[model samples]
Target: MPAQIYALDISGRRTRPADPLSGHRQESWRVNLLNNNDVLLTQLVGVVGGEFTFNVNAAIRGSGSIEYSGTPLDWNQHRVQPIYRTEAGGAAVEWPLGVFLVATPSSEYKDGDRTVSLEMYDKTKILEDDLIPASYQVAKGSNVITAVRAVLALSGQTRTAFEESTQTLATAMVWPAGTSRLRIINDLLESVNYFSIWVDGDGVFRTSPYLSPADRGMSWEFEDNEKSIYSPEFTHDFDTFDVPNRVIVTGQSDGDTAAPVAVAEDNGTGPFSIATRGRVISRYEEGQEASSQATLQAIAERLLQTGQQVGSTFSIQHAPIPIDLNSVVAFRRGVEAIDVATTLQTISYSMDTGALCSTTLREFIQ
Candidate 1:
């Protein structure tokens, strides 16, 4: 017996049609249609090309052909109409017809590794012709000493030390004296912890604390066409002097008088007090031989102490003055025996200079 086949119409309904023209068609051909899900087995049948029609409930829908009995079978179905010539005709029948069957080639699949490389580039440079100004203006009629004190207060330095340094610098320089005062003022400003001293007509004297060159709000650049200028040559002397007795006084006096009187008396005191007094006195003298050495040393020591308590409170080291009390004593005795009298003078310090001194804190007690 020929193998059974099944197919669906464009509407996807399944129906098995009868051969009305073939004598082989029985009055009631109970042809068994392939099971709905088992239709794929028809491919193994000998059917090569023919059309087959079948009917299924409205729920079954699809399109495709099957082969059976060496013939291609195409199947399709139409909705039953109410008006029918015969009641039997009204009954749906799945019809089978011969058709051409062709298998579609399958798609090819390929898999391998894919690699991609990415590159990035960037460039940066400054192109502006004019940059912001590097200059600062000193307020008119500003007292350098007051400014220094203010800065010192801001930096948390001792008011007494700041005031003392301010007074010393003020007395050392003539107020508003050209650019000398300004230069000194600029040199001393770093913060509230560091102060500067320069030798004026009177020996070593403090300036109103000003910002250090590095800390100054101002920056300098050579003119577009100007050449670099080097610093002037300076001589370094290492002569050592012995001091027998040294005295330091705080009161103001002429540093140029033929016989300058000691501002305070110094009885033989403890070594530390005597040495400190001697240092203070030696710092105040006639001629431009003033020494910031002592002040710097004291500031450095203070900085070290501050660092011990906190850490790296300031950027620059405080002044480092190495004082040998023995040397100081010998030097003082020589001066006393020779009756060498140096006058002390007082002058006003510039506002800018004073500001610098106020900011730097003393890092050491010495």
Candidate 2:
């Protein structure tokens, strides 16, 4: 694989090179940087040491981050992205490994080479730095999509990618002064079905709904066969300690009225069901932004409906591929019962040519 790294000015402004061979241009969605509406910088000249690894976790805030090592270059700016040509000179297909914030980097001096260890985080960290000022109030009956866009704009974000949300608020949403802007956004999204909001490969804020493994289809499959993608290692783990059959969700109460409450119980008649378990293993959560009992009940049901199959994870090592987060992948061991299915929760890999990648997948409830 042929790979190239691009940079942006410290102020996040630059022009995309008109020449394709200039090392500054890659086939990707043209994104205007957060600081300015310009393209990327000239390519860095050096040998990159570890994998060009990126991370996406099942989280509401700070869901993405990246780390890698390379020979020292003039890198004082705060932004970067990597593009790799899949088959060096074989095809034109390239992968843009997402833009990132480059603030904390360490260096090492070997026998002859000077390598810098660069660990950069996603743009969510930037949003976490800005606190919402006083008088930031969202009115009742406001659509959640509009509210999320408005809050991002207040933080000086102009580029965003959002899933549709036509659900309206039942009561006005208000937050006290001096709260993290990203926190407010997280709260607002839960009013709809979205639970994980993070930046994508092109450096744009994006949101998507959380679904059980049962609701998604497998994106890739692993088998210990010669025709497969060379999965060299495999590991499986099952975690049932925290699995809950009942979930109780409640909304905040006002000065005079009690909060709306809703209960979601395990209705499945499986081995882990309330019937089989012989007791109600319940989980409780609060602060749902709703006013009607129906809305609260829907949120509670969504929370309980996920991970009901005793959430587990299986890991594998294979050739690096650009699989999106929250993707469902399955593995087939020879034994019938050893076969497993799950969702891609965390992934990281290096930039070294032909370097194998190790990733972990969380089992989706069947």
Candidate 3:
């Protein structure tokens, strides 16, 4: 098997052929990237970025640590961009994973060996910053796509980072105090069924509708044989806390009379079942017109109907390219079971250890 390529470029620390001692190393380096629950190996557009730890052996130390000479891996002054490449045509080709944010570095000495571990985060950290509360409101009657753009603009993200949104939203929205931009945008997207958002391979933040498995045009077949490279795990959940049998939608503010109320119920529950499994109250969201009771009822019906279904999650290994967040995927569970369709929800990759690639998918009930 060919060796995986790992390279690093520090913004403040530059290296060249002329300098006798430059710390930049885009060639041979011993570094291992770590993954956590917060982020996955697959680079999805809206998902939080996984963390990486770079382990540098002391034997490669040229002029001691960055604390003394500040040659390489500067903790305070430099920003790191991790570059990934693969072999093709007997030469290395640029296979960019994504940009990384380097945290502080720590060192340890054991058995006459010195190693340094540098923590790093993906681009999702850009949304973690708190936004100024003054710039949080979107005007009424604005396009949903435009509302998202306005939020990103106030969050310090550049216009170049945005991609065209496939869905349109035409609701008035408000931003609460002390809220992060990520939280607000995610809420708005979900309200309109625009559940797909993530940074692409090219580092652009994209927004789109929830893609069904058919939209992606990819099918994965798993056989129960020893020669097969695929393994699958499934989870079925029915949480009453997340489901609501009755949904009450409250319309926009009116004068003296009570505000319009629209209610929806599921008649399918068993007689002995809990009279009310849950109750959801939707207020002037989901493009519901304030003055229209009919629009409020439509919103209530959508909420109640989506809340009454059995949900499932499927995870499998060796997922192919383009099998990313919100990609609708078809699954074949051998001859014994019928084919099922699900949406790709999460992905993880590991090239150093077993070259494993895995994906988790869920049935989009709504």
What's the best-to-worst order under lDDT?
Answer: 2, 3, 1
For candidate 1, write residues 71-185 as lDDT tens digits.
Answer: 2233221111000011122233232211112233122223742221111000000001112233323343344555544433332322132333332231233223232322333
Question: The CA-based lDDT of model 1 is what?
Answer: 0.24
lDDT for each residue of candidate 2 in 142-184, tens digit (9 for 90 to 100): 9888888988888888688787767888778888988878888
Query: Whole-model lDDT, candidate 3?
Result: 0.44
Candidate 2 deviant stretches above 4 angstroms: 1-38, 52-78, 88-92, 110-113, 133-135, 230-232, 254-257, 291-294, 307-310
**Of 1 and 2, which scores higher on lDDT?**
2
lDDT of each: 0.24, 0.63, 0.44
- Provide the lowest-lDDT 10-residue window in model 3: 55-64
Which parts of model 1 are misplaced by more than 4 Å?
1-142, 145-182, 186-194, 197-245, 248-269, 272-284, 287-366
- RMSD in order of candidates: 46.1, 7.4, 12.2
- Number of the top candidate by lDDT? 2
TM-scores of the candidates in the order shown: 0.17, 0.79, 0.57
Question: Comparing candidate 1 with candidate 3, which one achieves the higher TM-score?
Answer: 3
